[model samples]
Target: MSETSWITTPVTADILRGALELERTEHGVLPHRLPAWARAQSPDGQLAMAEAQPSGVRLVFRTRATAVELDTLRTRPAYPGIPPRADGVYDLLVDGRLFGRATGTGGNVLVLDTAAGTAETRPGPVGTVRFGGLPARVKDVEIWLPYNEITELVALRSNAPVESVPPGDRRVWVHHGSSISHGSNAASATTTWPALAASLGGAELVNLGLGGSALLDQFTARTIRGTAADLISLELGINLVNSDVMRLRAFTPAVHGFLDTIREGHPTTPLLVVSPLLCPIHEDTPGPGAADLSTGTLQFRATGDPAERAAGKLTLRVIRAELARIVEQRAADDPNLHHLDGRVLYGDADFAELPLPDGLHPDAATHERIGERFAKLAFGAGGPFAPR
Candidate 1:
């Protein structure tokens, strides 16, 4: 009971490595990308990260409501076609003991029940639930999903102590983007491009990827103003285009408003403004798809004969051009500010290389490609984002 005997060191990699191990399971928990955890389920399968070291911190998956279909993956094309829907209970276990359960149309809610400790749950399409107060030290974690379902589990992350690396060794990267950046179609928790980019760049990530929520709001910009980051990237345009969210007139001012707020706190930090990658659907076209708000479906149709281009539905080209202009104008006074064409990460040329299954976001392999490009371009040894 002596205080000296109770002293504990912070979480470290070595400590975590010695604490937990992942026993691969046929079922994995997918990353939740959309809002309210509703209408956000991707056709792609989910990727779950497992703990190699528990370090007294463990999170495991149990039963899932939707059948865990491995072939049905998001963020990329549906190779062999997307897997069929799953309907059943998938259970998660820790050391063979039930820790949580996911039940819903697409494995919506995860329920965790434990003692003493505190657990935090993030909302999903179904709902979110967490449990605390468990055996601090867990040895094994397991996932049980619908029968015949296989899951691709990504690297596990634990709340365990972090390694005692020097402050300089730790780099913080702040990124702002739409649903895609929020992980709309990525594989799992760690497979998102931002997550992958963070790992490749050796930087801690502050993902400001709000679903249907990245409207360049002043509130969002103000939020970034108060946060600290060593590197930052803003991926704009596509969401605005796809959603047919704004017109040229509104877009220009919104962009300025968003950047001005960030400038308030980060006058010199390296900033990169990225344009949207290519999407033929909205390249230079314009049209309001069958927006059956009643059913929440957007059936795109080519309604703008030839007059639309003459009129403008705010195509991607226009958006990209405006973004370039914004960055260029801002850069005249801010040397730390830079611009990267989102196409550089994934452009029309690469479309054939890695087509989106849903014809929107990049797939897992593409995510990796984009991550690598981001690291090399933004955080490479001699890149503009290198620590100064």
Candidate 2:
């Protein structure tokens, strides 16, 4: 098709969903999971990179166009010696059904070295991903962006004019967690555990799954507090253990403060506190997780001695117990609050059957399993998020 034959539409906030803020850049609009105020408080590189990836962000519009194309500039992270990661995928949904998938050709690369704690960006040209041959009818079309890569929406072109779709009445689910909830190793944006659960449970998802940065930060709590959500979930423990940023002494009060802040805005909202999924490396061991690159593949191992727990070092086991206790104590008067053991979603048995490929992060199949289990446990009848 000729370039001039397509109708170019501006990517505006009204047609976008799932992002906390929209950033206008020189290239185009960038979706940010963290608000500007939150990002400014902590200049941590890891948090900045993770928030820019747009795990659950997507474009929702109503159109009769059979052919659609999206122009985007993506920045994918690459390690020094390890193999380059796969290009991010763009998923097309027609009337809420997965219709097609495509990947951009080229854009930019951020070469990062965790050992050295350094990163360098190499610029490249924008790439176009096209989807053709849609059924001829006015329908709600959603383009789910890559959950892992930093993407800037440059231009959107369709054969026919696209109109913004009004928000639906689905319950809004606001979720915050580590890389697992951030869609790590998931196949695509819509296939992430949270996304899958939202689909099955009939809810709208606002994913606050920032990789390596879910450290019970106050800014994060404030952001979640301000967002409008019918259901709220905070996945804790793994990131705390992996980062070794706190001891048992600090973790206890931090959890309370985080929850306290959220409750200020959502006093009666259905809030569920979830601990880490079963990770043997950090189950009883503390972290400052070490990356094992000796085998030519990326793997993580806990470095802190298990004995340190006696001295107040935090571990997955310790955090889970503390979280349950805190929630139980708070639930006495807060009937709307609840707690769920993450192991219920992915426990030891599940781990033996489907081992984490990298000693962390669930594979695509496990993402599905966790999603289904979450839907059943949290959104099922008598569950925390079950229909009122």
Candidate 3:
């Protein structure tokens, strides 16, 4: 078919799901997990990059076109010594089922040097991903963007006119966490732990998993508070410890304040507080995690001494204990509030069976396990998010 024969549709907000805001950039429309106000408050580069990655964001519409093509400008990050990372994958879903997957040919590259604290962007051309041979009848279609790459929608074309679909009756689940929840090491966008769990639990996902930036920021908490959600979950501890942003004394009150702000907007919504998963490197040792490129492969290691606990340096174990205590104390008057130890999702037994590939993030298989466990624990019988 000729390119001119295809119907070109503007990528508007009506066909978008899971993004909190859409930015009209010079290149195209960029989806953002955090709203403009929140992004403005904290200009941290890591948070900006993560929120722009669109872990659970997707384009959803109803159409009868057998072929579709999407033009995108993707920005993938690169490091100094390590090999180039694989191109991000885009998943196509038809009638709520995975139909196919594709990768864009070329785009921009962002070279990040954490050791030197520098970043450089190299411009490139736009790339197109084409999907064809779909059933001709009317069906709901979703194009899930890559969870790990920054992407801007340049154009969307189809053989038939596409119309926006109405938001269904699924419960909206708002989730906040670190890179693991942001789809690190996950095979695709829809397979992220939160995304997989949302699918299994029959919930609409609004993923706010900002990698390396879940440091109990007030702006992030405020964003979550303002967003409408039927169920809310906050995954705390990993980022705080790895960043070594605060001590135990400050963390306790910060947690209280974050939750308090959310309660202002959602007085009785089911709120679940999740502590950090078991990371042996930071389980008992304090962080300021450091990169280990010793063996020509990227890995993480805790730098703070274990003896620093006496000085209030936080660790995964300490954070988990404190979080459980805080949740227990708060749940007395707030019946809708609950707590879950993330170890229950990926613990010692799990680690032994499926070790974290990078000594930090879970591998793709582990994501599947965590997603299954979360769906069963949070959405199953007698669970906090269980239907009333």
Candidate 4:
């Protein structure tokens, strides 16, 4: 067959899943986890960039194509002091199983020249991600893009015809949390804790794991409420405590409002509240976490004083106790709500075994361990997230 006979399909929102909005770029569509209205309300560049990168977005469709190609412009950010991050990974799943994988190459580069205290952003070459030798029979296919990279999908080409995959009965799990919930130090987009747990639990995942931005905000809860989900999980407290963004008095009310908004939309959805994982630095101390750049390596430091605990300051210990108390009190009226201490998954002993490399995010191994532990604890038999 000639090239003229090939079929090319525009990757539109209809065939996309796990993203709230798809904005058209010069080359392609940029997927945003947060909708337009939400983005407009906040002008924070960090949040905008984080949400624009589709961490949980994937291409869902049905086709008999033996070969497939996706054209995209990926933004690769370079940190001056440290090595350049790895290229984003693309995982292909055929009939709900891992079939093959591909790596995207060459796009835009956002250079953070920390040594010179300068930054630069510029246009980059487009790259093609290709996969071949798929089964000849009609089957379900999922292409999971890298969670960290900002990707603008230009087009999708396949040898065989393709159509949007219809939503099945797979339970949709919408999870909201911190960088830990996001792919922070995870191996890949598909292997994030929530992704791994969803796989083990046999549920479809809609991850809202925004890095450095999982505050118990009204918009986040409103996002969760507006979306359709069977199960909901909120991994809270880390960002709040580390940013030292709130005190005890305000923290309690914020938590309630966040949950109330979500409940307004999904009053009966099984909701799970997870407290912070064990972090020795902030376990006792407070934070307005400062960066330790002395060794030419990026590290975090706790800048908050410990004695402030008496002033109603927030700490991991304080947050956990408050979360447990809040959930216990609410559960009496709402039996579906449950709380889990994140320490059980990554407690003091586990931290001693697998220490955090950044003094913040978990290493890849820990992500897997946490995923497995969560799968068994929450999705296991008689667990709160167990299928009905």
Q: Which regions of candidate 4 deviate over 4 angstroms?
A: 1-5, 112-119
**Candidate 2 lDDT (Cα, 0 to 1):** 0.94
lDDT against the true structure, per candidate, is 0.53, 0.94, 0.94, 0.87
Report the error of model 4 at residue 46, Å: 1.7
In angstroms, give how far residue 33 of model 4 lies from its true place: 0.7
Whole-model lDDT, candidate 4?
Answer: 0.87
Residues 238-316, candidate 3: write the lDDT tens digits: 9999999999999999999999999999999999999998899999999999889898898999999999999999999
With a 3 Å backbone cut-off (N, CA, C), the pairs that clash in candidate 3 are none
lDDT of 4 by residue, 27-122 (tens): 989998988888787776556667776777899999888888999999877776576677788988999898988899889887866447665887
Task: Please give the lDDT score at residue 222 for candidate 3.
Answer: 93
> Total backbone clashes of model 1?
34
Ranking by lDDT: 2, 3, 4, 1
As a TM-score, model 1 comes out at 0.59
Model 1: ten consecutive residues of lowest lDDT: 47-56
lDDT, candidate 2, 1-388, per-residue tens: 4435899999999989999999999999999999999999998989999999999999999988989999999999998878887788899999999999998878899999887889999999999999988888899999999999999999999988899988879999999999999999999989999999999999999999999999999999999999999999999999999999999999999999999999999999999999989999999989989888899898999999999999999999899999999999999999999999999999989999999999988999999999999999999999999999
TM-score, every prediction: 0.59, 0.99, 0.98, 0.95
